[model samples]
Target: MQVSSLNEVKIYSLSCGKSLPEWLSDRKKRALQKKDVDVRRRIELIQDFEMPTVCTTIKVSKDGQYILATGTYKPRVRCYDTYQLSLKFERCLDSEVVTFEILSDDYSKIVFLHNDRYIEFHSQSGFYYKTRIPKFGRDFSYHYPSCDLYFVGASSEVYRLNLEQGRYLNPLQTDAAENNVCDINSVHGLFATGTIEGRVECWDPRTRNRVGLLDCALNSVTADSEINSLPTISALKFNGALTMAVGTTTGQGKIFTSLEPEHDLNDVCLYPNSGMLLTANETPKMGIYYIPFSKPVLSSSLNQSLPPAFL
Candidate 1:
């Protein structure tokens, strides 16, 4: 793999657009022996917060110092040390937490949104920004380089939150008019919002305008008895250049890297930096992925069928 020097992390990765093929002989040897993993890694369930709740969203700080988990329960927000998973802090909320987002470039503050129409920004110790939401729903972020606050979601509004200005922008007539905005992601000046209708739209955060729309809504025609698809758009992110990706609630995420007049998917990301597309529906798992495409990309090793989890 043509990796760049360590001094500059010029995408030091495992492979390229494809992946390095697995060693078929090595797999045969392992099958003969029926060897098992030597080390026993325990899955520790964190139990610092009182009420048991599933984390709908989780964010790790850029410096890898802390983690934030948000959910609906007694203690809505939980903070942990990234290194040891030690409980750092916790907060109880009056309403069920619908979303929790870390809205800082340097992990300085965290923002939690409630179903009761409220938004609060917090530091590690105390609250910094607290206001009632105009409506209820998921909000996407408008990322800025150095600042802490960004735009958030609502049932029928787009919020422009700030620390210094201490004011909110006039509600940018949002898509909550017809579809329930499920999730949002932003990079640079572009932001994308997903809807329960299975559609995703890209918006210019600076202009508060819809730039492009992807028709992912499930549709059935007159002669069809069965529903064709439940096109759920769960997550969105910027890839290379004008490229982007959309992950479904079903965990099958696909990438589109072209702007041609056709719906052609360029690649898929399963393993981080591997660029090996995953088309499986079994095991029910989650993974991180990145596209460090440079040159001399390696071929996928699925012939030997290496384990699909982290190496």
Candidate 2:
């Protein structure tokens, strides 16, 4: 989507702790105030970094305070301060970092996945523990505040790992066939998995069962070649307790409210606490999008009546 001006973009600052209702009412007031202001500014270019190796995974912390990134060919993980946009620290690992996770509840510890094992390291103390697993997975999401428990997606199955016990609790079942899980995300007590066939499923971690599902595949007969080939999901995330977003390998993506896709997306990061969405991608050019949530429509009757998928 092309943005005509910065005025077309609205970023509501919800940093101060406010209830959803209060936040929405405040946003509506602001929108009414800016409705006629014909001011526009060019989008400013931010700092850019040239990586030495292929950056495989990138994620922002739950509180949106820090950013954690790693590469496939490198054995090191880097931490960046979000506000300053400066490098904070880096730590080398024993093996190549396939994928890594920063616990939202506790950013002090991080977990990394190697060939067939996982390693846990403290932000300050360094390597604390490691475990050998039976299967390898692409992504992992923490189980609430339990630093030692998390979920891993491998193929079509989701495995719950008890880090303290060094064993899996039970495998969660998915309905998709030959569902090779490509990516996984967890937030707001919900777990979501994206598959190679371009489908997404949001599950309830407590029940270890599917709560909602989304089929992101384009209409085959009406889609062009590019749309048809872009069916493998490379990334996925939930915007808040309601909306969800997914990015595909073909450099395409979508944002969803309920089962119907609403907006095109790229590499997306949803901040539930802050009510903001950040999207980035590498295509003809590299760019980043910052979208702030307006609390006014968030609780609208139409939105509330949409579906469980939207909820």
Candidate 3:
């Protein structure tokens, strides 16, 4: 999507800091004001009232047609059409949105995981269903084959919610102190979890076994110096085969080759089709790097093709 200027983007205003009833009343008043006005005049009025805030999380739809973002003050989720760069709709939430997953390509099914342990299901029209988990969730991954939603949190267990059965199954136990983020490999169906103790653990959902582990801190340390503290694994993304991108609290972005940008990364995303790696740090701007995978690097240990060097 090409955005030339900020003024070209339209974000609907929620009138933050107001109660739900008051906000609804204000919206009704606006609707009534535009009821008899000319269509062109109403469009001009809407173009004048745009409120931009800090977005906590943002995700592009599978079909690349829409963008979903969550922001605070009074927590709200907004959907924007890529072609128009205009707000399609916005929904206010009871609590802050920790993360969300779009289940369908047409923006039909969505699941929002809140900081208060509440999971809300939303349809294209509006809210559909709701449930609660046991602990505060950090991240989640959807396994399409088994139709299970795996949630990891501040605890050592990964909670499994079966969307097909409409209930949660048994939680998967991990050896880490806390699970930070999880990602499922699209090709081989292997899911990996990044832990607070600086380790990435790979698992097989079919067998429920811990297949492999990578110690980030240990691998990062030079032969001459020792690490004072273990950097927390904050974000993870699997691109192709078993190739993964990892981000840490120490401002390290790794895919075999380490990159220290000196800012703690909030998230990392890989666009394998375009060979682009996107990393969001604590700063206002984001970093986009190119991954040169002309021929995948071979690893003697794993005997598989690894992700190539970054540029």
Candidate 3 lDDT over 1-311, as tens digits, reads 11122223222211111122234576675765566343213222111112244456666688877766676657887776756756788889899888888888857888999999999889988889889989899899899898999999889999999988888898889999889889998888898999998899999999989999999766655655444667778767775694676666665432344334445644444433443444544443333444344124312212322222100
Residue 284 lDDT in model 1?
16
True-structure RMSD for candidate 1: 12.5
* TM-score of each model, in listed order: 0.57, 0.58, 0.69
lDDT of 2 by residue, 1-311 (tens): 22222334454222111112234586674664455232112232222321344454556776677766654334566666767766677777777665667753435867777755664555555677676655666666666434334444455666677765666677777765434333333346677777777677777666667887777656221344454454666655454466554555564422223111122322344444444443322221222333444234333322222211100
Better of 2 and 3 by lDDT: 3
Off by over 4 Å in 3: 1-52, 223-228, 253-311
lDDT (CA) per prediction? 0.46, 0.51, 0.66
- lDDT by residue (140-217, candidate 1, tens digit) is 453554232334453445555554556665655556443333333333556666665566666666676878777654
Total residue pair clashes for candidate 3 = 0
> 31 in model 3: Cα distance from truth in Å?
32
**Model 3 steric clash pairs:** none
TM-score, cand. 1: 0.57
Worst 10 residues of 3 by lDDT: 11-20
